[model samples]
Structure formats: C-alpha cells, structure tokens
Target: MKVSTHQPSGLSAPGLPSPSLFSSLLFSPSLFRPYLWLAAALVASPLLFSSPALAHHFADLGQMKPTLSNGVLSGLAHPLLGPDHLLFLLALSLVALQCRWGWALGLLLVGLLGGAAGLAWPGLPGAEALVACTLVVEALVLLRRLPPVLLLPAIALHGYVLSVPVFGWSTMPVAAYGAGLLLSQGSLLLVALWLLRPIAKRLSPANLRWLALALAACGTTWAFSAWAG
Candidate 1:
C-alpha cells in the first residue's frame, strides 16, 4: 500500500497554520481598533491613581500658610507642583503659544478667574464627584483629540475643587498657606517644564488623556473623602 502525505486544510499551502482565534483577534488591525482605545484607557488608568503616591506630601503641604497674595502665588504655582496638573497645563500652554504671549496670559487669566470662583464659593456637595467627572471628561477630550479650549475650563475646576475648605480654615495664616501652595506648585511646574520639554511632541497624543484620567481619578477620591466627612 502506498501512503500519501497530506497537509491540513486549515493552513496555507506553505504549512502556516490558519490564524488561530488568539492570533486573529490579537493581530488583526481591524479587530484591534476598539481595543486600542480600551488599551489606551487601561495603560493610562494608573495615572488616575498617581496622586495617592504623593498624597502624603499634599497633606504635608496642607500645613503651610494661606494668604490672598500667597493664594495668588499658589494659583500661579499650582500648575507647577503636581505632574497631573503640570501635564494638563503644559499640554494646553503648548497650544496657547500659537495665539501669542498676550493670549497665553489671557489663558492664565481665564484660569485665575475660574479658580477664584472655586475658592470663594461655599463647598458644593459631591464636589469630589464633580472632580471625578471633570477628570473623566478631560480624559475623554483626549480620547477624542479635543482642542486646548477644553483645558482652560479643566484648570479652573481643578483650582476650585481643590480649594474647598477641608477643615482648618482658621489656624493657619491664609497668606502662609497661599504662599506655600505657590512655592510647592511652582517648584513642581518648573520640573515638569524640564521633563516635559523633551518628550512632549512624542507624548502629546496620549498625555492629555493620561493626565485627564489621572486628574479625574484623584478628583473622585478627594470628592469622596470630602463628601464622606
């Protein structure tokens, strides 16, 4: 009896196996499109949780003084201290330059005015929720390739939300607190400028979403703590 060798029909003539379920879904560009978004979300989710890593410091900084001029200074520096805030502002500031230096200041002014409202207002219930919502939405903006316009509002909300009186409004001199916040935030901003300068163009596409997600996550937690107590 003569025996003939036969190749599996599931494979190509060259003997390569057909795209397995794992390989097809994993390697197929069309199938991966939606997953690319989900992956972006997942890889970036850690940033949402990033603030906790620095929470001890924020708490330490809380002990600093709060003043009107200092608050003004903090307001200026706030964008500097934290990576989340830095990423958010840096992403926007990059775009702001297109408008001119005066326009950049205008952007800062808009942020300032918005922050003032946040500071001056009575604490809104579920502010943490609003914060979370802000972050999530901010992330969504990047998911959709949103323009810098969205960033200004985000910066404003961040200031107001963070400014909500946590408990001690009387003991610390307001100026001292404000100054401290500025000092801390400003220092960080400078750091962000240095680090962000090099990788910005490369990271720009995903940085906004990453930062927004991070901000929203932190805001949600803060809001939760605020609402709970």
Candidate 2:
C-alpha cells in the first residue's frame, strides 16, 4: 500500500509554526517599525527639548542680582536648558566612552578653565557662533570623520558659553556658579556614559552613523541661525 506523503492542511507539526507563517513573520516590515519610530524619536529629541527663545537662562539670573542660590541654580540649569550645550555634552560623553578616563578628566579641567577665562574676559566676540560650530565638530567626531581630540576645543567653547550669564557675578557667587555648573555637567557626562555603554554595544555602526548625521544637521541649522541672527 502506498503511504500518503503530504501533511494535513491548516496544521503545523507539534510545537512549531507553519513554514509560511514563520517566513512571513520573519520578513515582515512591520516587525521593525517600532524600532524605526524609536530611532526617529531619538533623532528628533534635541529639537523637541530645545526652546524657541534664544536665551538659555531659565530664571533670568542675568538681570537679577546674583546670589549664591540663584548662581548655583543658573549654573545647573544652563547646560540642561540650552540645546546647543546639551547636545555638545552628549556628544562628548559618546567620545568619552571610547577614550581613557584621564582624557575625559583633562577635557573637564579644560572646560572649567575656559569658564574661568570667560568670566575674566566677558563678551568674547562670536562666542555663540563658536559654540554652535563645536556642535558640528562633535557630530563629525561621532561619525568618526574627525579625531576624538577635536572635541577638546569644542568643549572649551561650550565652557565659555556656559559662563556667559554669570559674567558679572561677585566672587563668591561666581565660585558657587562654577561649582554648580561643574557638578551638573559632570553628572550628566557620567550618567550618559553609563547609560550609553550598553546601548552603544548593541547598536550597529550604521545606526551610530545615522545618529551622528542627525546631530550634524542640527548643529548646522543652529550655526546658521546664530550667524544670521
């Protein structure tokens, strides 16, 4: 007697999906759509977080008398509130992930010094434009089109911009502002590095390139606005 070779219709082997169903699930474009959305959100987050106002001051500390409390608060808020500054710090953190701890510390020190210099010599010409340029440089670094060392000057420019509001504060308030700025920026770097380490490990190089390109576009737009305005 001849045996039937075909399996029953509409039935898969026990504990296994049908071959057609498995292939459809595997190749379905919808399967990866959520990740695409997540990436888009990540790329657009800088614009979303940034304000339309050009001023970075969250409390208008520049116009008021600078006290130790407000000084510190202003210092802490500047980096977080300013899109250009925040994006630079994030890009720096990404570079830091690949470099030695000593390098990161050195950059931080340089930034602090830059802030001090800003206070000493306030109203550096084109300071805002310089800060915007740094963002583009940082994006290039992330894309591996530039060396990580290039981030140093960019960071120093950021430090200078960060001190712009606190330029005329008294000695004590200035010190407090510096301290708060250091604390906030350092914490941001450390936290970002910690969080990105795992995610960076999992993401492909192509994904990172896309992120870097997005940052570059943002930087370019910011730079144009700064120069034009």
Candidate 3:
C-alpha cells in the first residue's frame, strides 16, 4: 500500500491554522462587513440628534392616575426619553444575542419586575455612575473579555436603575407602566436580535469585536456626560 500525503487548498499542511494566523483572522476588519454599518450608525446617532442629550427624569413627572393609557404612555415614553435607558436596552439585547436568549430574556423580565416591585423603596444613589458602569461592563461582556455570568447581575442592576425614575407611582400606574415598558423594550429587543441573528451567520469574530468597541465608545460618552452633569 502507498501512503499519500496531501493537504487541502487554502489550509495549512497541518490542516489547521497556526495560533497567530487565527488571531489575525479573528481581528481583521474585513471579516466584519455589513454589520459594521450598524456600529457606524450607533456612533453617528448622537451627533445627528440632540434629543438623547436631554436626561430623562420620569420620577419628577408629578402625580399620575392609575389609568391604562397613562401607564402605557409612560412606559413608551420612558425608554424613548432616556438615552441611558436606551443604551442599557441596547446592551441587554446584545448580551441576549451573545448568550442564550431564553436565559437572558427571562432574567431581564425578572429584573424589571423586581425593580418595579421595589418602587416604594428609596432610589439608589449614584444612579448615573451605575448606569455608565453597566454600559461599560456590558460592552466588555460583548467583546468576550468578560465572563457571561456577570451579565445577570449587571442586567439586574440596570433594571433597578431604569425603574428608579418611575418607582413612586401608584400601584395600578406602576403595574401598567411596567407592562408598557416590557412590551416596548421586549419588542425593540426582539427586532434587534432577529435582525442580528442573520448577520451573525456571516460575521467574523472581528465584527463582534468592532461592535463591542462601538458600544464602549457610546458608553464612555454617556458616562462622561452623566458624571459631568
């Protein structure tokens, strides 16, 4: 019997890439194609619109009746009004995409409900810093530089921070508001996750890294503004 030695084209003679080569391929920008556009958009949005600069202070909205309309409107408006809230939501979606959606999404709901339940409790101090830190941590998690397990606690904290503004509302209003927020945020997250799932199939690891970097930049800017103000 004759022994044949052959290697596949475009592969090393060993039939596997060397560590350095693999790392290079992983970090190469060309790997991230269509999705890079999204990172660019995230970077550009704040510059294009001035609305995000305004801090959302839902807590100060004065008294509201326990009506369904008010609850839904408040729920819809809160996430839209606060850039911080939006940032946190974006981070949550990203984590859900990276990890198991069922687990991540479930924890997100639990956190939100827990937060709403604690509405009567005093608001957390240093909320701005906490939010900024959460964004930063989430970006790191997305980059694969942090453990996925930490995400649960971070997301839970985010829920608390997000709910703080509307905590003092009456029971019916708070319940209704929580429902609205869940609907709005859940819809936004589902859409984003669905869109990204397809793109992820074609994306290189580098693309995810770039996306994380973009998120980090946004988080940094948000943190600075929050701390400054």
Candidate 4:
C-alpha cells in the first residue's frame, strides 16, 4: 500500500482569513460604496436644509414660554439642530483637534462670556453675518493661514448668535440656558477631541489642507447665501 500525502486546497488555518476572502474585502468596490454615499449625503446636507430662518429658529422657541425647562431644552437643541451652527461647531472641533487643550478651553470660556454679553445686549448688528464669517475664519485657521488666537472672537460671535433665542428670559431661565449651552457645546468639543485625536495624528498635511479648503468653501457659500437672502 502506498501512503498519500494531501491537504485541502482552499482551507485556511484557524483564526486566519483566507487569501480570497481577504482580497475580496480589501479590493471590493462595493465595500466602499456605502461610505461614499454617506460622505456625499453629509456634504449635501447643509445645501439641502440650510437657510437663514432655520439657522436661528431650529428649536421652535417662538411660542414657548421662558422657563428653566424650556430654556435648557432650547439651548441643548439649538446647536445640534441648526445646520449653520452644527457645521460651525464641527469645523471648530476639527480645528481644535490640532490645538493645545488650553486654547480650546479658552475658546469655550470666551464663548460662554459672549453668550452672557449677548443676553445683556441682544440684537448685535450683523451678528448673523459674523457667525457665518466665523466659519471662514476657522477654515483659515485650519489651513494655518491665520492664527488660532483669531478663533476667540469667532467663537464669541457664535456664542452671541447661540444666545439670541434666549434673549429677554428671566435670570433663572437664562442661567439654565447658559448651562445647557455649555454642557452641549463643551461635550461636543471634548468628544470631538477624543475621537479625532488619533485620526488627526495620522492625517497628512495635504489631507488637512484639503479639509480646510472645503470648510472655507462651505463657509463662503453659506455667508454669501445669508447675505443674498
């Protein structure tokens, strides 16, 4: 009798991927289609939903009474709901990912102060324009064309715009609203910092530069649309 030596032709070892399986996953165009669609949707969202009216009135506070509960709810929802505000914060987070923690915190503190100032002095002229312009300034900062220190005034303007809805509320409600804003915006920044830290470290300068240019284009378009409308 002759002994035969043979092995399975296509079997991979335990806990290891087969070459075919790995290649399919790595080289499959379908695998990346969903990601492409998602990116397109994200890029188109602001154009589809953004408007001057929606920018400041996202929380439907028009008829709501100024109460602690309403203020808190409004504050929490305002930034998340408004496309302009959301975009600004997202851009700010990306920018912050490249900066020192102290600078980021200082921006947050300055934003809080700006909110307080807004409550005291509502209806800052060209405030909407200013808010829109902040995005452009942030993009410049991201590109290293402008200093990070410039973010301070831009964030302050954002705070002022954020507080516009809470204007004329009583002290208690106003305080509650401010707390909510701090909680919401602060949490957003912190989370962005944590999540993006690794990605930021790995990003090439060219990639970051492209991101900055995209942000600048978005900001410029939004600002122009606001002015036109």
Q: Please name the candidate that would achieve the greatest lDDT relative to the true structure.
A: 4
Higher-scoring candidate on TM-score, 1 or 4: 4
Pairs with steric clashes in candidate 3: none
Lowest lDDT 10-residue stretch of candidate 3: 47-56
The residue ranges of model 3 lying beyond 4 angstroms of the native Cα positions read 1-43, 47-55, 58-66
User: CA shift at 207, candidate 2, in angstroms?
Assistant: 1.0
**TM-score ranking, best first:** 4, 2, 3, 1
**Model-by-model lDDT, in order?**
0.50, 0.73, 0.66, 0.74
Q: Highest TM-score, which number?
A: 4
Model 1, 198: alpha-carbon shift in Å?
Answer: 1.9
Estimate, for each residue in 106-129, the C-alpha lDDT of model 1 and write its tens digit: 554455455457656746665444
lDDT for 117 in candidate 2 is 82
lDDT of 2 at 11: 44
Across 1-229, the per-residue lDDT of candidate 3 in tens digits comes to 9987895454234765443453444345785744665676776686324333354556357655557778777777777677766766766776777678877667668668556544645566655656666767888887778887776666666567666656556777777777887787777777666655545556678877887776677667776766776
* Pick by TM-score: 3 or 4, better one: 4
Relative to the true structure, candidate 3 reaches a TM of: 0.71
Clash count, predicted structure 2? 0
Per-residue alpha-carbon lDDT of candidate 4 for residues 30-109, written as tens digits (9 for 90 to 100): 87867765886687665534774465754454688888998888878777777666777777777777777656766777
RMSD (Å) of each candidate, 1 decimal? 14.7, 10.8, 9.9, 8.3
* Positional deviation of residue 157's Cα in model 4 after best superposition, in angstroms: 0.5
